[model samples]
Target: MNRVYILLGANIGDPWQQLAAARLEIEERIGSIELQSSIYESEAWGVTDQPVFLNQVLAVSTAYSAMECLDIALDIERDLGRVRLKKWGSRVIDIDLLYFNEEIINTERLKLPHPYIQERNFTLVPLVEISPQYLHPVLKKINKTLLLESKDTLTVKKHIHEHL
Candidate 1:
C-alpha cells in the first residue's frame, strides 16, 4: 500500500460538517485513514477576502496509484458540492494531495509532495501535528521544521472542538 497524506479544507456551508462527510467518503473510497490531525482555522491563503478555512491533515494507506487517489479526492469534492469558481475562492470543500510515499511527481493534473507544502503554514501546521518528522521529498526537511521556517503570515489556530 502507498502511504498518502491528504489535506482537507472548507470555508463555506458548514465547514465542520463538510470535513466530517469528506472523511467518511475518503475512508469508503480511498483507503483506511491511519492518522488525522486536529482541525485548524486559518485565514484564506491565495485570496484574503474569503472566509477563514477549516483545515486538517490525514494520513492514509491506499493501494491505488497517485492518479487514482486524485480522482477519488476530486469525486469527494464534487460530492460535497464544491464549485471552483475562482482560485482559492470560498468553497464547501477542498481536498489536496500533499504527499505520496516520498515520491515526487509533476504532471499536468497532479503534483506530489505538494509544490507549496513548505510555504503554506495552513498546510504545514496541521501536517506537523500528525507527521512532525515526516521528511519532504524535495526539500529534505521535516514537517515541523518547514512549519517553523514558513514565512506565511496567515493565522492558523487549532480548533478547540474534537468532533471534526
Candidate 2:
C-alpha cells in the first residue's frame, strides 16, 4: 500500500459539510485514512477578497500510484463542486496532494510534497498538527520545522467545531 498526505480546504457553502463529504469520498475511492488533523480556519491565501477557508490534513493508505492519486484527487474535487476559475480561487472543496511517501515528483499536472507546503500557514499548521516529524522530500525538513520557518503572516486558527 502507498501512504499519502492530502490537504482538504473549503470556503463555499457549508464548509463543514463539504469537508465531511470529502472525507467520505476519500475513504471510498482512496484507501483507509490512517490519521487526520483537527480542522483549521484560515484567511484566504492568494486571492484576498474571498471567504476564509476551513482546512484539514489527512494521512491515507492507498493502493494507487502517485499519478493515479492525482487523477482521483482531481475527480474528487470536481465531484465536490470545485470550479477553478482562477489561481487560488475559492471553491466548495479543494483536495491537494501534499506528500506521497517521501517521494518527490514534479510533473506538468502534479507536484508532490506540494510546492507551497512550506510557504503557507494553512498547509503547515495542519501538517504540523498531524505529522510534525514528517519530512519534506525536497526541503529535507520536518513539517514542524517548516511551520516554524514559514514566513506566511496569515492567521490560522484551530477551528472550534460546534458538536450537536
Candidate 3:
C-alpha cells in the first residue's frame, strides 16, 4: 500500500461537516485512513472575496494507483457538489491529493505533492501538523522547513476546539 497525503477544504455552508463527510467517503471508496490533521480555518487564497475555509490534511494508506486516487478524489468532490465556477472559488467540498508516497509524477490531470503545496500556508500548516518530518521529494526538505519558509501566512488559524 502507498501512503498518500490528501488535503481537505471547504468554505461554503457547514465547512466542518463537509470535511468530515469527505473523510468518510474516502474511507468507503478506498481503504483505511492512516492519520488526520487538526482542522484549520484560513482566509481565501486565490480569490479573497469569498468566505474563509476550513482545511486539514489526511494521510491515507491505500493500494490504489495514482490515477485511482485522483478518480476517488474527483468522485468525492462531485458527490459533495464541488462547482468549479472560478479559480479557487468557494465550494461545498474540495479534496486535493497533496502527496503520493515519494512519487514524482506529473500528468495532465494530476501532480503529486501538489504543484503549489510549498507556497500555500493553508496546506503546509496542517501538513506539518500531522507530519512534521515529512520530506518533499522535489524540494529535498522537511515539511517544517516548508512551513517556516512559506510567505503567505495571512489569516491561517487552527480550530482545535471545534467540531464539524
Per-candidate TM-score against the hidden true structure: 0.98, 0.97, 0.96
Candidate 3 lDDT (Cα, 0 to 1)? 0.90
Model 2: lowest-lDDT 10 consecutive positions: 155-164
CA error at residue 110 for candidate 1, angstroms: 0.5
Question: Model 1: clashing residue pairs?
Answer: none
Per-residue C-alpha lDDT of model 3 across residues 1-164, encoded as one tens digit per residue: 99889999999988878998999999998768989988998999988999999998999999999889999899889998887888889899999999898999988888887999999999999999999898999999999999998888667888975564
Please give the TM-score that candidate 3 achieves against the real structure.
0.96
Candidate 3 lDDT for residue 15: 88
In angstroms, give how far residue 117 of model 3 lies from its true place: 0.6
Tens digit of per-residue lDDT, candidate 2, span 1-164: 99999999999899999999999999999879999999999999989999999999999999999899889989999998889998998899999999999898988998887999999999999989888998887989999999999999999999888831
Name the lDDT value of residue 101 in candidate 1. 99
Compose the digit string of candidate 1's lDDT tens values, residues 10-64. 9989999999999999999999999999999999999899889999999999999
Give the candidates in order of TM-score, highest first.
Answer: 1, 2, 3
The runs of at least 3 residues in candidate 2 whose Cα sits more than 4 Å from the true structure, single-residue gaps closed, are none
